[model samples]
Target chain A: MDPISLAFGLILDPYVLTVMVLAGSFGLFMGAIPGLSATMATALLVPVTFFMEPVPALAAIVTATAMAIFAGDIPGALLRIPGTPASAAYTNEAHTMTMNGKAEMALGLSLTGAILGGLFGSAVLATSAPVLADIALRFSSFEYFWLACMGLTCAAFVSSGTAVKGFVSLLLGLFIATIGIDPMSGHPRFTFGNVDLMGGIQFIPAMIGMFAFAEVIRSVTATTPHFRPPQERIGNIFKGLGPVLMRYKVNLLRGSVIGTAVGALPGAGSDIAAWISYAVGKKFSKEPEKFGTGHPEGIVDAGSSNNAGLGGSWVPALVFGIPGDSITAIVIGVLYMKGMNPGPTVFLYQPELIYAVFLSFFLANLMLLPLGLTAIKSSKRLLLVPREILMPIILLFCIVGTFAINNTVFDVGVMLVLGLIAYLMEENGFPIAPAILGLVLGPLLEDSFITSMIKADGDLLAFFDRPIAAALGVVTILIWIVPLVVRLRRRGRLPEGVG
Target chain B: MKVNDAVPGAILIVFAAGVFQQTLGFPPMPGQDYGSRLFPQVIAGLMTLCGLSLIATGIANRHSEPLFVPAEWMRSPPHFVNFLLLVGLLIFYILVAGWLGFIPTAFIILTLLMTRLRGRGHLISTLAIAAVASLVMQQFFGQLLRVPLPWGIVPPVYW
Candidate 1:
């Protein structure tokens, strides 16, 4: 069958359709909550995916992440508290718009912009992934080592906080990844004689612990003041969105392009993409003075950019098997668990599955329109769900979900310990996303490095002998050195970039 | 209680040192030049450097202001007590959930947390919510998804 026909048939399966709706709703719910995130939404779905077919499993993650990114705007508009970090960029502007009784217009523009940006990103992914994968198929261990280094370097540099802290987090994750038996040496590294540690640290449980469990602790200790839901009744969310989108069409296009580009880069994700697009939008806006005071221009651009970045992230993940962001990092784990090892060969080997994954992005974005509207309309009621009830329920789910992964109480113990570790790390301003990415990529990094070393007979210069590897190695080195050079040239002054 | 960045920085440095020491004990591969310890040793070295930089940054900023900013809930005894209670409940669930079973454990934890935290006088409503949520989650995850929730004393229902 033709790829398009095959993709349609796969997506149209009753099981896939049902899973999409359920996942979409769950994503909306998670994103509408003040403390929950897109990463947490995906992490929570890992157990559910265990019961699903590969197509539906991939579909669930794709659909859920898109919905979550868009739904983040609901809390930002109503409560001035961004439901997800991606919405943090424009939360003040969205809240200001809400105060001025333009909440519907703000939400409508966000919804529309997300759809457009997502479709644009999906287009880029569909066209670029195959070509990129074909080229990436030529890569050997030498190329992969540099590629992994490039990813880790990007993780350290791209994060908004202290670069040292980001590196520390990455190192911590890499250390955790080293706990299992050595792939090449066939010796246990850090199991410390524990039987459960032999299989290494379970990724899903650690993820649930860090993202969901830590969130539960932070929410309960709850220092932030809760505002009563705004009295403004949301009328036609689509109202006046068309004129605003038309007026700021250039901003929308620029945001989508920038977001897609950023998302394709390793380590940078939708949150960073949204913040960058918003900053860029504000910089070039004709009515810059109107920003943070009910301005729709930045909102339009950032909303589009964040969702677009989601699709863009899939590019690297599907093509190179390297995650473009933390979400894709988890998606890569899911891909591996599903026995769909992502790489250029996947394009040739599983064309139908790849096309179906791409098509699901389109379908998910289309579904976002109706689902997002319903979410915005009833957002007031949604926010009213007391944390006292919701949090405990979430806690129960976390416990059950961790256990469900390996069906072991030992995994729950891992979850508890790691959850505490994550909380402490975040409390000290350490970025957790990079750590998660490091854990996902650590084994790949080790395997590639070892293979390359053996192949070269311990010659360090051999890594740079291949033209592609040389170029990649040079690029990675430049990424590390250029930032330090700039920092030194400025006499230790940090660039005024979006944190 | 929150400590200054210097404390975490110091802890990381020590931790990295310990890891580096541990890597010295890993048995080398017989034929390959790169052993199991090479990547971890590299990670430890990087961590040590980063940890030193963090320590420098923290000490440089120390004279400016107090680094510890306690949460608002910590100021109030009742709130702090409530927070501790919740933590204790989480630990309790982790310890006994397998033996007590998911449905009963979840029901008890959710009910207690809700009543103490937000339920106040709405006892009946809180109980209803706890029961319903526990049942729905049990049925969805255990039966529908085949997660094998511990049965404990409750009769297991097959769907």
Candidate 2:
């Protein structure tokens, strides 16, 4: 049930080992492509995994996801496109290094940092999951409601805009979430009795719509922003991995720690993890002013944080039946439907399988070094795919991906409608990230809160009765109020008729 | 800044009122006081409050410049209209696709959208993309996932 048994499980199966390497390589290659994404890679492969034994298939996916996440650093460093949004962490910093004629070193440092971060995360997952699961098992409905609130509050606050707008957007998400069945009473709130509405909005379609379609719509409508040609004739992929390691040692360590923390927080996800790590690293650095241009510190911190998020996300999922990121959310669904209900009982029921997945994470992180090196070396050609052709193919993928989820053209319609909504919201001052967060977390918050209240015989204070729930409530309120206090203190007075 | 924040406020106010009215159906008994509509009504009240706040903020910020995107949005109304038209097309496709089947509905929508959005001369991209999408999705979703893609009044697409 521990790391040793898990490692042995991988060794016992030659096919699983072979599959792991190939999947890792494939993930690295796909994620290295500037336009390709980890979510799509997983989505496309989920069907393939359906035919395989759950244990080995899960190992393959775990390895591939890590590789893909690490591979994202390649595109960010070489092409400045950020192969995925999580790569947005080190994007400006890493690409700036490429412009400054140090692309090879930049890629090498981040690749190394990603592996190290992944290892750190895996170590934490290996050691702490049982205890975490025990703690999670103690949670009541009240605790779950508080946790959901915390997750949403973290995501909403992390959104890159005025906090008020973020809250409003989150409110909009909660509003949309209300358009379905009420769990406690079994009374449908906003379905209006349409049979199609009976099942509520499927998460897969909504996710595909928000991330894939909305992004594509934004891409086609807006002027295609081009990156400046890299100033450096980039050399070897692993060039100068040694000195860059020694140079940003502190930054790398701090970033990995920050990444693991943020990733453990449900809904904050990978993007926030990387950004927070990079910001903290830069804040604490000896030379803070030289950050935006071409700083290895920035790349290491961001890259480490994002990669570390891989394992951190699993902690919550394995322990609490809660997903910390989008990919983890999908993984949780697959795990449950595979006949392994993930909770404290999962630890007791299937210890070896859980350990095997954890060990696979460790191996995957180690594999990232070689896979990421190949990706960095080969990323230059990806930028030359001709945008017009590439855009159409991506659009097609979005269409198929969105449609395949529900097999309903209605979902595709929803995707397009959401895309248009996303575009307008982007055009106007409103931030769309909060809307995504709201959509993802809204149902969890509503169901848990209502269930907890009902269990407590209509007492609203039940949420605060539990010590954990009370602490989370205090933290959520503090998350809102502290920022407001800081802004007012900084400005010395409220700007005009604000209050 | 010109997004008519008052509209959302009015909508929230009305929703809140509607939800609060449902609370009347519950007896004045102690445990039944809040009722099933209680939480939603509370959320609606919160939404109204926030919506009103937004209205007040929008008005205060009206004279000032838009913070994020700026005032150049009206500079390209046609582009916006194209997006709206795209949304409209999707709505029509969804409403009618069940009756017409996947291929015809998808092909029609895709071809029209490709022509309208990308311009008239890319005939090859339009046809190729439309046709290819139908075939691949049909095979993958219908054959692979076993979700049974909806067939319409028309004959089998390929069988």
Candidate 3:
């Protein structure tokens, strides 16, 4: 009945191993497809996990997500299309490497780096989650408000597009989040007499609509053909990977550390971690100009960071029940459903379960090596599946997947409506990820804000009374204000700088 | 079709106005200084500012080549028609899916979409794919997951 033995017994069961392999294959399929994503893969698995035990259920998600993040690079290397947003950060560099006749090397680099980063992140989670959870157990509504604010700001500012557009997308998500009954008063806010709306928008359906449905529409509407399979055969993916790994050893380690830290943050996730690491990698590289020109340096850093972030994201979710990103948001919901509410108390009550979850991260990443290489070897065949036939099947999955969530056709309608809106939003250059982050964090933000207000007797200054809250508030304010200050300062000295 | 950036901004402004007005109608809670309307109103206020900024930016760059970029497939009338038809088909499935049953409904839509998107030559192949896929999914969800996907006109097959 010790923690180690319990963890081993849960993980080593034949049923658990079978689920891991099956989920790993499913994740590979979803991640290797250009229009599918890791989030969608998780969403699709939710119904299946409903029938599983707690450990197997958690294993299903953990294995699928880790494999999906790595398999995303397969399409990016074979074709220019990125399979997931996390892979999108280095898609151009990966494709350029393929065009340069190093497809094997490119895929190998992604596979090896992802495995290393995931292992490193899992180690961090195993060591620090209990300690972090203890600290988080001391937090009140005021501290939570600042934490959520910090997360929202990070998501908005870290986007690659204009800050205002990102913020607008975020606001739209918050608005959507407000559509159900107000938690404070038990009064409906924006349901408009539809009984289904009282439950608010379903997260799984909305996510499927935004990520999968929008992509389907985009792919169907495109005039250009993208189905041409690459002529180059990928053989011995690990052949030339050693030199690249040796050359960029420090970058890989740096990216893993940076990625894990960012993933541990409440708002930031794998995509943001990949983007920042790629930018930083380019900034610090000796041959920065070689980037985006088939260079493996950035891929070594960003690719590793993206997968490492999968483990890192679990930190906050396990510690405080606050999701680190959209994936963890879904995980938190599942954890609650399984009667394993996340917090410092859970570490004491369900120590074996928590340790088993952490152990699954290790197994999933180690499994990524063989599964990822197999996916890469067969990438050409996967590409030839023909979008004309493939797209409709994906559409079918979306409809059924959305319906499976609640066994109601109402969710299907919601999916279509959100899909149309998301398509338009993306067309207008508004980023969707921040909006997703908004939806996931919106309730948390509102609950904490309202609770803090009530606790303070309507005094806003009380939000800063606690030392940790004050520090978090200061950091959040700086994240928002400093960028504006710097922009204003640059405008005044533009002529002098140019001269 | 691609529109001026100002179009989205203008739409957002109207949306924010409507939401802000609705928030004003919520009754205040007893003993609570901040009601349900407060957070929504704050969001509306920020949205208004963002919309205005987008409008200004769009107008400032109205003459840029990027702003006038082609709307891609929308310029082709047939492609646009097919896109609308697909959207309509999805709505149709949502409405009649219960009566027609999930398997038949999904199968029909998938066949029509594939034929329209790829031209009509692969109808038989598309039909087989749709039929087999729908049946497999029906068994998986209905029998395995215990989800009651409407059986409708088809005879019950446990397997």
Provide backbone clash counts, one per model: 0, 0, 0
Superposed Cα deviation of residue B68, candidate 3 (Å): 7.6
TM-score-superior candidate, 1 or 3:
1
Model 1 regions lying over 4 Å from their true place? A489-499, B65-69
TM-score of chain A of 1: 0.97
* A233-274: candidate 2 lDDT, tens digit per residue: 557756667787788888878888888888888666677888
**Of candidates 3 and 2, the better by DockQ:** 3
Off by over 4 Å in 3: A89-101, A240-244, A286-295, A491-499, B65-70
lDDT of 3 by residue, A142-228 (tens): 988988788788777765578888899889888999998998988898888999999999777888788778878888888876757
List the lowest-lDDT window of 10 residues for candidate 2 chain A.
A223-232
Residue A272 of model 1, lDDT score: 96
Which 10 consecutive positions of candidate 1 chain A have the poorest summed lDDT?
A490-499
Candidate 1 lDDT, A1-499, residue by residue in tens? 8877998999999889999999999999999988889999998898889888889999999999999999999989888989999899999999899888888888988899999999999999989998998899899989988988898888877876788888888888888999988878888888889999999998988899898888988877776666677677889987767888899999999999999999988889999999999999999999899999999999988999999999999998998888899899899989999999988888888899999999899999999988888888889888888888888888888888888878887888788888888888887778888888899889989998888888888888998999999999999999889888987877645554322
Candidate 1, residue A209: Cα displacement in angstroms equals 0.9
Q: Cα miss at A420, model 1 (Å)?
A: 1.5
Best of the candidates, lDDT: 1
| Candidate order (DockQ) | 3, 1, 2
Error of 2 at A79 (Å): 4.0
